[model samples]
Target: MKISARSVAATLRDPGAWRIVLLHGEDAGLIRERATQAAQVITPDLDDPFRVAILGRDAHDRMVEECTALSLVGGRRVVWVREGRDGLTGLVKECLATRTDTLLIIEAPGLESRSKLRALLEKAKDCAVIACYPEEGRALEASIRQMLSEQGVQIDPDALSWFAERASPDRAATRAEVEKLFLFAGQGGRLTHEDVQACIGDAASVSLEDAAFAAMVGDRTGADLAIERAMNTDRMNPIGAARALLSHIHRLRRVRLAMDAGQGRAEAMSALWPQVFFKRTEAFGRAVAIWSADALMQAAVWTQQLELACKQTGSPDIVLCKRHVARLAAQARIMARQR
Candidate 1:
């Protein structure tokens, strides 16, 4: 039967009927959690090493064969297929058709509406599919509030919105952020916006935020420092950082254009095609003050040029990234002064 993630928690509370289940989501944390719970149900004794068999596409056939084989030393066995994709979908279908008593758990990236694998799971009697999408806005806020309440912690509405605004795009990151907030609020104290800001936001996020803010406010030195810190940390990929910065610049350009057409800041910001963050409000405001409509238009041109350079350059990823950040910093400073 088909089920949602919310249902998975309750259905997994008693997994006696589910022999072959698939847990797939963009949220690695949720997928891993559900997989662990299903594995535990199949094997209550955690010490038994043979109770769990984790495999990938390459060993799909062998793992399914082993699961179907007679149990040698354990009452139940679980075969978890990680990163299973289209290549192994046929193998999964074959295994499910054969009806193995051992539980089969498959995890993959999110599937679309017409996905064959998704359809297969939906149609199967003993199989199930779970989808995970990025959480934001009200959905994210509600999740944070629920998590905090469950932990016996209380947070005001403003603080809850703050946490949600800064939360990561995926469930794993969100869960980690909430857990950090809970720990920070320890001993029955109400969590405040400051507390959320202090503990929930990581150095990497802060650095990225700073880089974006610096670019918006036309601060070459600050932008350079932020990019340098981000690169030196080695936690974020250079290519990923460039893409994020480009996205920010694009958002700013859009907002600027709308305002140029006689729209107010609130309307222009609201009319932005891409999503904007509350954290960006101050930086965006600074940018509007320091740059004219023409300046922002030119900034957009520079942004595109940097994008092309980064893409075309044969240099190493790090070097390419550094060059782009430096160029952007210089451009931002020039534009800020022009305004």
Candidate 2:
């Protein structure tokens, strides 16, 4: 009933008795993709209204009927419920009890661990539940590689990491970027580092990464320039840069904490999740060695507060973000001297 992350793909390919499948997660694109895959297993033509019924949250009162109905084409029907919520628990339960030939796919984006529908699907032998969380680090890179591989697009290993660095954390955004790359590369075309930099890289995201890494390592000049480019070029929001900085700080903290726990710096860095982007590896290593765990923790707090300030309506978000970056750079300078 409950599909492990490892078994999700395999199960979706051959969901023997699972008449109702629930896909829930923060990754909306992943949910849509898995649901589509599962539905196609039962009915290939999702566009065919006779074999497929797409129901929104408000119009789901007839979900039970849709699930029990047979397709006009004489095969199994597919009932896809979009924007699922707790209101459909009873209907879903009813569908399970009725033993219908229709395969039900539910798209629930924000279902909580205690959600009744999620719970029911997990417990019911006739149902399957799959959770999709955003991928990060190596996993994110692997996902990009797989997407390209499936599209018959080839990318050099270094270029793949560079592209992954700019890839948005949100799956939908990442998918859009990947699709654009697909068009740029064409079928069976190869992508090199320069090719990806030219087509996929933009100033905002790259500058954001630059600002984050530079701020952590006492590169005040580098941090200043990168922050300005990120906020001014490509209409990058200060809040977004603040988040990127926060993420980098957290990553440094994780590695620093590991070093504090008796692991060598090289080993700890090697074990970083979503390993350091190839271009940033040296800078990241320097930042990790320069900042102690406590300093990194304090910097994280500063970055977090900066993010909260950026959310204030009509606030000078860019100014607020810059001040924090300056403070972090100053702290990094002091740490460097002491080291």
Q: How many clashes does each candidate structure show, in the order listed?
A: 0, 1
CA displacement after TM-score superposition, residue 83 of candidate 2 (Å): 2.1
Query: How well is each residue in 77-168 modelled by candidate 2, as lDDT tens digits?
Result: 88899999987898887888896788888999988889999888888777889998888767888889999889999988888877776777
lDDT accuracy of residue 14 in candidate 2: 80
Leading candidate by TM-score: 2
The C-alpha RMSD in Å for every predicted model, in order, reads: 5.3, 3.3
Which whole-number lDDT from 0 to 100 does residue 209 have in model 2? Answer: 85
lDDT by residue for model 1 over 1-339, one digit each (tens)?
688757866777766577667766677766766677777887866456577777876777675586686667847777788876656668776777676688787777665567677778888877767665666777778777878888888997767865676677877777777788788998576887667778765566568778877866767778778877887775676666766676776677777777778888888887653344566677787776666667666666765665566666574766766666676667667766675
Residue 204, model 1: lDDT of 66
Candidate lDDT values, in order:
0.71, 0.86
Q: lDDT (0-100) at residue 28 of candidate 2?
A: 89
Please give the lDDT score for candidate 1. Answer: 0.71
* TM-score of each model, paired residue for residue: 0.66, 0.82
